[model samples]
Structures are given as C-alpha cells and as structure tokens.
Target: MQLTILRSQLLSGLEKVGRAVNSRSTLPVLAHVFLEACDNRLSFFATDLETGIVMPVSAEVKTPGRTTVPAGPFTEYAKTLPTQAELTLTLKDGKLTVKSGASKASFATGDPGDYPPRPTLAEADHTFTLLPGVLKDLLRQTLPVTATDEARAILTGVQFDAAPAQLTLRAADGFRACVAQAGYESLPLAPFQAVVTARSLREVLRLLDGTHPEAVQIIADQQARVAFLLAEGVIVFAQTLAGEYPDVDQVVPKTATTEAVLSVEAFIRACKQMRVAADKPREALGRLDLQNSGANAVKVTAEGEILTASETTLTGDVTVTGQSMQIALNLAFVLDMLEVIKTSHVRLKANAPNTPVVLTPEGVPGLLYVIMPMVGH
Candidate 1:
C-alpha cells in the first residue's frame, strides 16, 4: 500500500476508528487497524467483535492496497508529528513504513486477511432515521443508568422502543431507572423493542459527539446487529443480550401524596455537602426530613450525622409538599438525578418510606427518575 495523506486528516481518521480497537484483546489482529487506500481516499477500520467503526479521509493514493498495523503505536506516533506535515505510508514484505519530513519509522505488519470482516447491514429490510442531536441526548441521559454487572445480562443493554411517532430509551441498574422520550417524524414498524449493549450505545454517542452529524441512519436486522451510518463514517454493533426488558412503566408510581418543588441547585448543593457526612456510614444513607411549616412553606432538612462526626443540615422553604414522607435514600443516587434534571426546580414525591422516590423536572413530566430508598435501622 502506498499513500500520502495530510497529517490532520490521517489523525482524524485514526482517532475515529481507534475507539473500537481493543488494546488487550485475546486476538492480536483485533488490536490492529485495517488501512485501505483507494480512489484518492484512505479508510481506517477497526473492530473488537462487539463494535466496529470505519472512517474515510481524503488522501493522495499512489497505489491501491490494504494492510493491518498496530493501532495504538501508529496513532501515538502520528500524533507527535507536525499537524500540517504530509505522511507517506508504504507496505512491503510484511513491514510498514511511515515517513514524515525528517522523521521515518517502520513497523511490522500483519496479514490483512486475518482481520475480521466488517459486518454489513442490509439496507432493504429495516431502517430508520433520527436527528443526531435527539439520539445523542437520549444516550447521554440513559447510558449512565445501564447495568454493568454481567450477572443480570439483560440489564446490561439499553432498551430501544420505537413506536409510530415517539422513540423512548430506557436503562436501569436495579436501584435507579432513567427513561428518555423524544418525537420522530417517522419510524419503521419492526420489533417494537430491541436491547443493545451499553458499550455500543456509549461508542455511538462518543462518535456522534465528535462528528456532530445532522442525522443518522440506523439499520437493524433479525440477527440483532445494529448499524449507524453518518456522513463520514459507519458503526456496526452486536447485541449482547436478548430478552424482554422488565416492565419499567409498572415500576413508575401512578399516584403520589407528598410532592415538594425545591430548587434543583439548592437540593444538589445540599446533597453534595451531606455526601461528606453520608460517606462515613456503612450504607451511605442520607436522611431527609420534610414537614409542612405553613400553608405554602415546606421545610426540607437533609442531615448526615455519621460522616461529618457532626450533623450536616440543609433547610429549604418550598411552595408545597405534595405528599409528605420522611424517606432515607442513597445520597449518591439522589445527587446524580439532581445534577441531570434540566429544570430550575425538582419535584420529589414519595408514597412511603420503602416505596420508590420519584423525581421529575418542574415543568416536564415525561422524563422521570425512580430511585429506590434505603432501609433505615
């Protein structure tokens, strides 16, 4: 293979596909990137079985050929060269040479045929389109809540529900669940739901965040492989688990008695301060005391006496407490929800001490977080 490419273009292509290269893979070929030069363009491809990415960049192609080289060493080496330098690459006798200005390096090459074939999605059977921003937002909100434990294999993947006009993404790690809903103009009528690995979802988000494409085309087949196509690249992901996700809708409470609308910032700050004290407890529980001070003023007190060696107090007077319940909850979980809420105020509802505590954005009801409470001694 022989190609001359601008350093910036080569680096951009390398970084995009490098995300899928596993540095510590049992199969050595998985650690290498496939470099193919053709038609005045260079394409970089990498796959770790579960996820694959392909990035195409403009290059001056002198000869059409393909080869595989260690991704980590090549990427690190390219980064040190001047950004505007022109990189010349050639492959001969199982060796690859890289020359830029006064610096030159050669690395052993692996047989390109040994690299795994990039999975392709059939364009005819099932397809859908989504605004890149909408899909990116859904991932940002739900991916963090996905279960990482391999024991509950099903919970490791985010559930994608595509209906007629609305798309919803749901993820849970048993203690907390996050559901994000958005509207789409049109969607394909296929399996109403599919479970994709959290790793796949994260990779897609990482790629989209860097490239920021206007829209993305998604293809899913009966084989459970999902592919995302954008302007500059494509990502194909393999589903890790296959099963019916638990009925999250049933877990969301239908009714509540005590709801308090408090400033999100204040609640978050209180939770942060209380975290220091809560950390001292074996279970990391933060106690919240809510009471009706007057017709319109509700007092919120979050105290963590164990960690502080003293009591940590956060008092806030809010307009109302919908249903009053003194609930003990995990401080870290509460703080995570508070940080992500987009509204100025957060509404907290609880039916009982053991029941789930529901948090909703002040004006938005669709996005809801259900956090299970901690048992107090």
Candidate 2:
C-alpha cells in the first residue's frame, strides 16, 4: 500500500479505530491497524473479537493496496510529527515505511490475512434512526448503571427496547437502575430488544463527536450482531450479549412516602463535601440526614464516621411532602446521576429506609434513575 495523507487526518482516523484494538490479544494482528488505500481514500479498521470499528479518510493514493501495522507505535510516531505535514506510507517486502519532512520511521507489517474482516449489516435491517444528541444523552445516563460483573453478562450491557411509539434504554447493576426513553415518529421494524456492551456504547458516543452524524442508524440481525452507522461510512459494530435484561420498570417505586426537590448544583456540592468524609469508612457509603426544617426547606446534614466533621445546609425551595427521612446511600452513585441531570432542580422520591430511591429531573421527560439505599451500621 502506498498513500499520501495529512498527518492530522491520519492521526484522527487512527484514534477513531484504535478503541477496538486489542493490544494484548493472542493474535498479533488484532493489535494492529488495517489500512486499505483505494479509490482516493484511506480506510482504517480494528477489531478485538467482540467489537470493531471502521474509519475512512480522504487521501492521495499513489498505489492502491492494503497493509497491517502495529497501531500503538505508529500512532505515537504520528503524534510527534507536524500536524500539517504530508505523511507518506509505503509497504515494501513486508516492511511499512513512514516519511514526513526529514523524519522517517519503519515498522514491521503484520500479515493482513490475520486481521478480522469487517462485518456488514443488511441494509434492509438498518431502518431505525435516532438523533445523535438524544442518543448521546441516553448513553451518558444509562451506561454508568450497568453492572461490571461478568457472571451476569446481560447486566453489563445497555438494553435497547424499541416499541411502537417510543424507544427506551435501561441498565441495572443490581444496586441501581436507570431507564430513559424518547418518543419516535415511526418504527423501522416490529418491537424488539437487544443488549449492547457499555464499552461499545461509550465508543459510539466518541464517534458521534467526531462524525456528528445526522442520525444514528441501528441494525440488529438474527445472529444478534448490532451495528451503528455514522456519517462518512464510520461504523461501530459489536456482538450483543445473549440473555434477557432484567425488567427495570418493576424496580422503580411507583409511590413515594417522601419527596424533596433540591437545587441540582447545591445537592451535588453537598454530596461532594460529604463524600470527603464518607471516604473514611470501610463501606465508602455517604450518609444523608434529611429532615423538614420549615415549609419549603429541608436541612441536609452530611456526616462522617466521627459525626463531628459534619456539614449542614438548609436547602431552599425544598418542597418536602409526606414524612421526613434519613437515608444512607453510595455518594458516588448520587454524584454520577447529578452530573448528568439536565435541570436546575432534581426531585427525589423515597418510600422507606431500605427501598430504592427514585430520582428524576424536574423538566426532563422519560428519564428515571433509581438507587438502592445503603445499610447503615
């Protein structure tokens, strides 16, 4: 393969597909980036068995061919070159040569035959489209709640449910669950469900930033492979986990014995301050002492093990209803939800001390977050 491309473009394409490169794979080629120079365009491909990514860029192709080279060292070398310099890549006798200005580097090429080929999604199956911003929001909110336990592989992925009128995303890690949905105009196919790994979801988000595609086209085949198509032929594909995702709706509390609305900024600040104290405990759970201070006010007290290193803030506009309560919860989890909530204020609903607390933004529709309370000694 012989090609002349801008250093910046090459770096961008390399970074895009590098997410799927398995640097420690038993097969050496899996850690390398596959380059195909053809049709005045250069394409990069990488896969780690479960997930794969393809990215293409405009280039001046001198000779149309293909080659595979280690991604790590080549990417690092490209980063050190001038961004606007023209980078020339040539393959001869299984050795890849890189030249720009006065600097030159050579890397041993891997056998291109060993690189896994890209999987294609049937065009007929690629009918569903979702707004990039909306999809990005859904992933940001739900991915954090996915379980990391490999034994329950299903919980490690974000579940996508496409109904007749609305599309929903749900995730649960046993301790907490998140459900987010948005209404759609039409259905490309019948209602269906699939689970995509959280890692793949993050990669899709990254690709959306670079491509900023109009809408993400989703395709799920009978073989359980899922693919997201972006602009410029950029695609993120992965194998769906085999199993049923837990019913998250049942875990959300329908009724609340206590409810409070607090300023999102203030609540997050209090949680962070308390988290500093909570970090001392073995369990790493933060303690929240909520009590009705007055009509439209709730005193939030954050205490540590000594209880003397406590901070109290009387949150205003706090419309507390029903009974007052104190709950222990994972501060990190609460902070995660707070970071993603798109609202000036957030509503918290709690039924009992041990039950999960439901959180929802004041104006955001079709988004629900539930966190199971922590047990106190």
Candidate 3:
C-alpha cells in the first residue's frame, strides 16, 4: 500500500483503532493494524474478537493495496514525525515504510492472511439515532453500575432497549443499578433490545466529543453484533453478550416513605468528609440520617465508623413527607453517583432501611440511580 496522509490524521486514525489491538494475543497479526488503501482513502482496522474499530481517513493513494504492520511502532513513530506535514506509507518486499520530509522508517509487515477479514455486515434488523450529548449522558449514568463479575455476564454490559418511543439503558451489579432513557424521533418499526459490552460503550463515549454534532446511528443485528456508526465511514462494533439482564424495575420502589432535596455540592461535600472517617473502618461504612428539621427543611447527617467517629448535618428545602429514615451505605457508592449528577440539587427517595434508595438528578427527566443499602456499620 502506497499512500500519503496528513500526519495528524494518520496519528488520530492509528490511536482510534489501537484500543482493539491485543499485544498479548496468541496470533501476532492481532497486534498489528490491518490497513487497506483504496479510492484515495486509507482504512485502519483492529480487533480483539470481543470489540473492533474501523477508521477511514482521506489520503492520496498512488497504488491501492493492503498491508499489516505493528500498531505500537506505527503510533509511536507517527507521534515523533513532523506535524502538519504529509506522511508517505509504502509497502515493499513485505516491509511497510514511513517517510515525512527528510525522515523515514520501515517496519516488518505481518502476513495479512492471518488477520480476520472485516465481515460484510448485513442490513440491520433494527436501527435508531441519538445525539452525541444525550448518548454520552446515558452512558455515564449506566456504565458505572454494570457488574464486573463475569459470573453474571449479562450485567457486565449496558442493556439498550429500543422501544417504540424511547431508548433506555439499564445496568445493575447486585448492589446498585442505573436506569436512564433518551428520546429519539421516528425509531425503528420493531422494538428491539441488545446488551453491548462496557468496553465498547466506553469507546463510543470517548468518540463523542462535545464538538461533534453528528447524531450517532445505532445498528443492531438479530443476535451476533451491534455497530455504532459515526460521522464519515467510521464504525465501532462489538459482540453482544448472550443471556438476559436482570429486571431491576421490581426493586425500584413506586412509593417512598421519605424524600429529601439537597444541594448537590453540599451533599457531596458531606460525603467526602464522611469518606475519610469511613475508610478508617474495615468495611468503610457511613450512615445517612434523614430527619425533618423544621418547616420546609430536612437535616441530613453523614455519620461514619469504628475507627474515628465523624458526623455532619445540613438542613434545607421542600417538604419532608412520611417517616424519618436512616440508611447505612458505602460512602464511595454515593460519591460516584453524585459526581455525575449534572444539576444544582439532587432528590433522594427511600422507603425503608433495607430497601433501595433512589437518587435522581433534579430536573433531569428519565434518569434514575438506585443504591442498595448496606447491612451494618
């Protein structure tokens, strides 16, 4: 393959597909990028079986061909090359050469025959579109709650339910669950659901920088794979996990015994202070005592641990309905959820000490975060 591409574009395309390269793979070809040059474009592809990324960049192709070269060396060498200049890549005698201005380097090319060829994906059984910003928000809320335990394979992925009107994302890891939905206009004719790996979800999130205004098109097949279509011909695909994700809706209480609205900053601050004291204990547990302080005011006290006792309280806002409640929880759980809440205030709903506590970003519709309470301090 002989092509001249802008240095920055080459570097960007290399870095984008590098995530799927597995240096420790049994097959050496898996560690190298498969490059195909055709029609004045250079396409880079890398896959580790579970996830794959393909990026095509505009280039001047003198002789259209294909080659495989070490991903590590190509990315690192491109960074050292002069920026804002064009990079010439040529394949000769099974060696891939790189040149820019007066500098040049050659890398031993791997046999392209060993690398898995990009499959010809069929017409999607279902498809939908989502703005980058909205999809970004949904991932942030749900990805964290996905179970890391491979035993419950389904929980390790973010479940996408493409209903008639909305696309909902749900994740749960026994202790916590995140359920969020984003609206999409004119969704696919048939409702479909699929669970994409967390690793792929993270890559999609990385791709959606705030600047890009393109709505990401989500394409899904019957069961094997799902691909995220970005601007241009860029596509990110992943193999879906087999099995059914748990239904967390039953644990989500329809009624709350006590509800409190507090400043996000204030609650987060109190949690941080409680963090230091909670970490002193073996299990690092903290307690939240929600009590009615006065008219339109409720006091939230964060109490921590066996090693060093710590407590802080603040009172504020709305009506504190029903009975007072005290919830024992791990401080890190709340802190993680609070950091992602993009709002001035947060609403908390709790039914009982043993039940789940739901925290919703105030004024943000269609988002729910539920954390199961801990047993003992």
Q: Per-residue CA lDDT of candidate 2, range 232-263, in tens?
A: 88989878898877889998889999998888
Model 1 per-residue lDDT at 142 = 82
Tell me how candidate 3 scores on lDDT: 0.82
Each prediction's number of clashing residue pairs = 8, 0, 0
| Model 3 residue pairs with clashes | none
- Candidate 3 matches the true fold with a TM-score of 0.93
Q: Model 1 scores what on Cα lDDT? A: 0.78
Q: Which digits, one per residue and each the tens of the lDDT, describe model 3 over residues 1-377?
A: 78899998898888888999999999888999999999998999999888888988899999999988999988998999877988898999999999889999999998888898775468678888888778888888888888888988888999999999899999888998888988984476578888999988888787776127468888888657889888767788888988877887878999898998888898888777777765453234678877765554543334444435666776654456667778887767777788887998889899999989998989999899899898664
Q: Model 1: residues >4 Å from true position, as ranges?
A: 189-191, 234-240, 280-283, 293-317
Q: Ten-residue segment with the worst summed lDDT in candidate 3?
A: 298-307
Evaluate residue 284 in candidate 2 and report its C-alpha lDDT on the 0 to 100 scale. 48
- Indicate whether candidate 1 or candidate 3 has the larger lDDT: 3
